[model samples]
Target: MNTPIDLRSDTVTLPTRAMREAMYHAELGDDVYGEDPTVNALEAQAAAMLGHEAALFVVSGTMGNLVAILTHCGRGDEAIMGDECHTFHYEVGGAAALGGVPIRTVPNGHDGLPALADIEAAIRPDDIHDPPTRLLCLENTHNRCGGTAIGPEPFRAACDLAHRHGVAVHLDGARIFNAAIARGCPVRELVAPADTVMFCLSKGLGAPVGSLLAGPADFITRARKNRKMVGGAMRQVGVLAAAGLVALDQMVDRLAEDHEHAQLLAHGLAAIPGVHIDPSRVHTNIVIFEVTDPLAFLQRLQAEGVLGVYFGGQMVRLVTHYGITRADIEATLVTVRQALRAA
Candidate 1:
């Protein structure tokens, strides 16, 4: 237990030395005035990489999501999303509280896309009693659905369906690079169909802070104002954006290692007597397994120096990120063996 294996989440990863160096050397400017050269450069890079007309740097994934929801929908309107989506389950209900947007959920399919029929059925008609379907949100490498990646065809179908209903699509692409790698695709290709997209620099890429929201220039322009209204405006923030630049340039391609580690963990955990998960569901960098007594299971893992998160009071999640290594995975397996034997 001398050294901890922090599999709690990818967001816990510390910046690499190269990222630290970039942060120290980043040129500073007034970001509120849009004069931060480094921030501007990073946003432009992200936008181009994602095939979007423009991008905005936000403080966190929650802020990025909240702003996007508010900006995309009218008050009393609705956005359709996965029932277990990060925006719905983890973002503290900011959309409902601040945006007055009703979140209509479509049950998540095993592959993480809402069933086409379910999505279509969830859309409201032009009736006065029902709220308008203002937007549709998609999560790539969906977190709660065992990190499943939505393939291009499925994504295109969903986008096409949403567009037919005159609903814009916003992607909460928190782990999109993982999805891109898992699918042997590029981030731009996965996000191409969505009208607006947000990806986290802090999650798998190991940036200390920030998420990028990209869309058409006009949408980004409105998002900027929405961010300001929510008190997300900041000054001299290029310091953090510098590390995000490092994440974009250097941290993306290495996500294959995390995915490999996650699959390894999933397969190993599946061998345990009490762990229940279809290892085939371990597609990306997240391993979610059901445990009979998650609190006891988590305590045993923590006592053994392997840490993770428990969801829905029963499912436990182990996420592999830039910080976890193959050797660490081996160590984790040994610890799991010991914990199970002792239990």
Candidate 2:
């Protein structure tokens, strides 16, 4: 049988040959002592790319967001986010569990942005009864919202509103490069208004591991300590940083191909009678659709060597990534059509 066309998530991506070569030759030192040259270089590169004064490399996007929350908010302070955001649905509640910071959720529009008015209303007024709202968390290419890429103007307005309310913004930018590519904008432009932003190297970028949190120098200093508290500090980890550096250098522009493949997949899925999807809603690399029997459909697809995930209820999510070719997408569509006909 053929290798399964793994469309479950971009996190399943394998690093490229160039990334393997870089990892093998990476310069190493103890990152805990801040002496890892390759790691330092990756952080500096990420900071500059995101238009921030500094950056911290963390084990994952979840850890990076947790460290940012720990650094930005004191105990008992609240952080606000979209109800459908990855941090709220995923991430294991680290902010509240570890940092004592509670999260308040605002409804996310279909386009993956919390309404500015809703955000403003969620901010706590000065009162002894309310937990101070200190942070507003945003996601670009929001995972649970069918991977919708929030455009720059609306994103900037949301950040501006949070700032006006004395709320710092933390962006879950795990797939931000995809958003930038989809919107035809520079990555810095999308991230400029955020107080701090975390982007993953492992997901769409195809790095083997790691994410970077970029922001003001002082904030990063505090985040560094928070990282240590979360046991994210590493020693001789430049090998991983080297792959991340290669990912940043070579993996960004090619994301457009993944976006195209996703469009093809979405349109093809929409054509199938039993599959429900709006191809126009597919702005990035993720394709989410509804089926009458998600589990049965996934099982049938898996049997035919196509793999996707059953997202809650009747929703199914398939992510196009570095290894998925246009040909693979066509094969997936054929399989789906056949499955529906057989059913």
TM-scores for candidates 1 onward, in order: 0.98, 0.99
Q: After superposition, how far is residue 228 of candidate 1 from its true place, in Å?
A: 0.4
In the range 1-343, model 2's lDDT, one tens digit per residue, is 9999999999999999999999999999999999999999999999999999999999999999999999999999999999999998889999999999999999999999999999999999999999999999999989998889999999999999999888899999999999999999999999999999999999989999999999999999999999998899999999999999999999999999999999999999988999999999999999999988899999999999999999999999999999999899999999999888878
For candidate 1, give the lDDT. Answer: 0.92
Clash tally for model 1: 0
lDDT of each: 0.92, 0.95
Worst 10 residues of 1 by lDDT: 334-343
Q: Give the TM-score of candidate 2.
A: 0.99
**Candidate 1 per-residue C-alpha lDDT over 156-257 given as tens digits, one digit per residue, 9 for 90 to 100:** 999999999999999999899899999998778988999998999999999999999999999999999999999998999999999999999999999999
Task: After superposing candidate 1 on the true structure, give the runs of residues whose Cα lies further than 4 Å from its correct spot.
Answer: none
RMSD to the hidden true structure, all candidates: 1.0, 0.7
Name the weakest run of 10 consecutive residues (lDDT summed) in model 2.
334-343
